[model samples]
Target: MNLHGWIIYNGNLPGNKFLDFAQWIQAAATRKNSTTTIYKNNELLSYLGIGQLEVLRQDKNKLPDYVVFADKDIYLAKQLEYLGVPVFNSAEAIDISDDKIATYQRLAVKNLPIPRTIIAPKIFVSGQLDKTTVQLAMESLGFPMIIKESFGSFGEQVYLIYTEEELYKMVESLQGKAFMFQEFISSSYGNDLRLQVVGDEVVAAMKRSASDDFRANVTAGGTMTAYKPTQQEEKLAIAATQAIGADFAGIDLLFGPNNSPIVCEINSNAHIRNMFDCTNINVADYIIGYILNRLN
Candidate 1:
């Protein structure tokens, strides 16, 4: 448990949440009698064109025994992995989780439960969609559909389309970007479950519910309440995490009919601040413990 680790997070993001994640992990590692270094994603200069496997000019620093990657910088994650350092959640898992389209495809391939999703075709320009394609998505998903931009977080780019006009507008705005259409889980209108999965176990679980919007993100006015997950919920969450090749993730579950749980989304490097505040269970400890268990 005395291994040295690095916690990497996006420094460009305009909030304290990212830093808070890194600091919490650092603290947890300290508690475990381990040393940690926190680095912003940008601070590490990834050597690509220079034909080097290392990053940054400060190569004098010893390579970390393990890395807690909390950023979407896949190149940096992969570079560190290429050097044989263990990165929790892995680069591939983070890539798949960052793209909703890829995430659903992986889950479906594994025969896991997920909401019905239809991915929009790739486009280079923003404009009106061809009637045929729009009609297909509409007929397949129907009204009150969920249009989620492939690369977004915290439900900011996810929309609840209630009519044709709204759908078209949302689609037009996202025409050139990667997005998907999903059948709305009316049963989970404003409520969802978040199971923080660490190394095949559901360490902490919470129910997030919003009164104003369909999104159950705490930043979107959703309130988090500590909740115990059922056997089925835990199973699906653990399976979904593995489906994306992740050892750790925050798995969001939607309430499906007949008391079933559906995979809504996965956060490979899910922030633990909110969960810690809500559940009083620090996943940072779980993460450090999990990493130490694996490394040692």
Candidate 2:
């Protein structure tokens, strides 16, 4: 059986951490008696002769059983799908999971409680930002709201707005970008859960808190501590991951008023950090194993 894992990225490998993960996968696959491939070209297919690349133009007689696209680009994922290789989580699923608005809408429709959200157009028309419309949305869901660009990762584009003035400033600053505005949930415990899901199962989970900052992402200097998941939180994490049809994911969950658990966001291509120390699960190995399982 032949299985190929593709590391598609836009630039130089971000850090040694990525390379470390790749090395771990390499070792794991070797032990399993499987072949693994890494394609590191970041330039566009046309610029770099993607037609000549084995992934783009597969050898009809030697097609790979599974292909994993690790890049943040959706276009490349779609191109691979067109070539008939069964990609993990497929291009369509990646496209949906990457967008914040779509992620919330899909989860909410499934009866999964998500914070109240509103999507504003990329370029606001003359009447698009009527005061009454904004007021009504804010009335039911009050201050200290969150606003985020449609596609961002590692807590880079998330914003916390506390007052009307700040909201206007944010809207004006982000006038020409796709954004999602939502009410913020103040966790009574002052921490949020990070659940890593692999193919419909919650493999590793942790609680992260930025005691000094509002964002709970470790990249933003948050402290990641071991968290024990309640039976309900574990089930919710699995359901949310499956709802988006993600084979491997990082689901952000929060506890709102009355201790109601809510899903904040679903992540594609999640980086595993502090996960191994807390859970000792070898999340990267599990992710690679899932891909191999589908191929077998």
Query: Residue 183 in candidate 2 has what lDDT?
Result: 81
| Candidate 1, superposed: residue stretches over 4 Å from native | 49-51, 126-128
Candidate 1 residue 9 Cα shift, in angstroms, is: 0.9
For each candidate, how many residue pairs have backbone atoms clashing (under 3 Å)? 0, 0
Residue-level lDDT tens digits of model 2 in 1-296? 65555544445756765555555656666676667665553543522354543333333334555566666567667666666777766776787788888888889888998888887755644334656656775676688888888888877888888898888778777766788778888762347889888886788888888777777888778878777788888888888887887888888888887766799888876767568876777777787788788777
Instruction: Return the TM-score for each candidate structure.
Output: 0.96, 0.87
Clashing pairs for model 2 are: none
| Candidate 1 lDDT score at position 74 | 95
* Positional deviation of residue 241's Cα in model 1 after best superposition, in angstroms: 0.6
Model 1 RMSD, rounded to 1 decimal:
1.4
lDDT accuracy of residue 266 in candidate 1: 97
